[model samples]
Target: MKWLWMTGLVCALFASVQAQPQPLPAEVQKRIDAIFDGVVDRWIVQMDRWWHDGQHEHLINMTYFAIMLDPHNISLYENAGWLLWSSDRDDEAVALYQRGLRNNPDVYDMYYELGQYYYIRKRDYAKAREYLEQAIKFPCEWFVWNTLGHVYARLGEREKAVETWQELLRRFPMMPVDQMEAVRKNIRDTMTRDTTPTAGENTQQ
Candidate 1:
């Protein structure tokens, strides 16, 4: 039964892509895509149940199945990558994110996820910086800038860190009041530390 269901899904997707010898009307194409999205969403809900039940193997298998059905689902990639990383399958997690990047070259979230993996898991500050830089080149959420600032601070680039948080404030004036205040505090604290002379410097003076 599972194989039949899988085969049906594959056939449907193959037909949608390959059988379209002539261009489909934009509306028709959109509706078809929406139908497939609905199907994928149902499967994802089942995967969530498997996740909560501690069925790790089933969850992993269903994750791959879901990705096969909808390679463009960024959340699926993110969840799967994080799951593998948390399971101590570090290499697999990296490979999954890399595959997501290949499929979603323009996606900022993929780059951000890779940056986070390096930052939190490997403590490879330089590698994290590389990916975070790429993430900022595209449209992204404010956390991208926030994380980049933290990464710069980790690398001992205090000036860059301050500049990054400042840029975030400049670009997102309408950010929530609490978040704005937090960022302001970050900038102030960084600048204060930047200017305050170290004990060695005070002794030299």
Candidate 2:
């Protein structure tokens, strides 16, 4: 449970480094490493630390070390990004997901995360579609289709959303009974709602 959470946070940290310059000077690098090494050394001891806990300061600072290790490390990129996102650095978050996507597209749960970035954070439906499409290709157990349906709806393609949900129902028949019914209702309701907005009504008359 917490394992994924912690691991994800670490990965984002790697991505945050992308927005900044490369490795620090020899003296600075050693100091930063020592600081992070101390915090990492305490992960076992301070797993329950609150967000405001002092241990987190160094933890955040230590992210640079993860980035310094290997540019192609997917986990580190993800961890760096999560940390940066937590600190309200969303652009940096998107940058990390993209950078990670470059080296290996199958790194962790990146596709879903990138879709979220484009969908909610960046407000770019086209880019959202791109990431969500990549996510659906993976064998993830996350909210890919449901979110993709919502993305289609946001793009004013209600029919696309309805059909997408239907497609999901066809492919994943074991969907929860309530959710299955909900999907059917959503399709029907979306169809009904779409019918009422006539071509004339949508015009600038």
Candidate 3:
């Protein structure tokens, strides 16, 4: 009876301690929580500071907080990755997108951004194609097909571009009207720009 009573007391104490709000560390957690407190209101202030002082690390920390505060908000992850990418942190941006996907696999748009990041920023076209393919697996995302078409066009895969456009048309007969002319414009632009210039023009004589 005595041993059982002691075990119960210990379990209750452990539960109480676990229930208490933790004193978040100063390194990133404290700062992030502070951002949660008023970070959105002063978001512009923090951004301006990043621009003026070139303190991207701080900005990254704040973004971490924003994401933590609204765990369900996929846009927070998008904004964090976008800012990091714009600031020339391609590796960090990639990691952020990967982490975001782990948390919110339903956020299809991150795949699009990750694809663009791979193609444009990292110059890893193969990885870009992989991500864009994943993005297209999601629903009602004709825009994703448009992006894939551009990627294939840039890669000089004419067959892929044609197939992409065909898929877009098949999905949306009024595709141009439905997607604000983006898919139609890509189809037209890729088909138009695909001309094999004269051999003389191809090689600067």
Q: What clash pairs does model 3 have?
A: none
TM-score of candidate 1 versus the correct structure, residues matched by position = 0.80
Candidate 3 lDDT, 29-130, residue by residue in tens: 555545445634455466557747877666666666555445555666676687788888878888988888787677577788788788667766678889
- Which scores higher on TM-score, 1 or 2? 1
Could you tell me every candidate's TM-score relative to the true structure? 0.80, 0.58, 0.61
lDDT of 1 by residue, 1-205 (tens): 7834864776577566757789888998788778777777888887788779888767776776677668889988898898899999999999999989998999798999999999878878899999999999999988899888878877778899889999998888888888888888777777777453232321100
Worst 10 residues of 1 by lDDT: 196-205
Report the Cα lDDT for candidate 2: 0.64
Query: Which parts of model 1 are misplaced by more than 4 Å?
Result: 1-35, 194-205
lDDT score, residue 152, model 2?
77
- Model 2 residue runs over 4 Å out of place are 1-59, 63-83, 195-205
Model 3, residue 137: what's the lDDT?
A: 81
Q: By lDDT, who's the top model here? A: 1
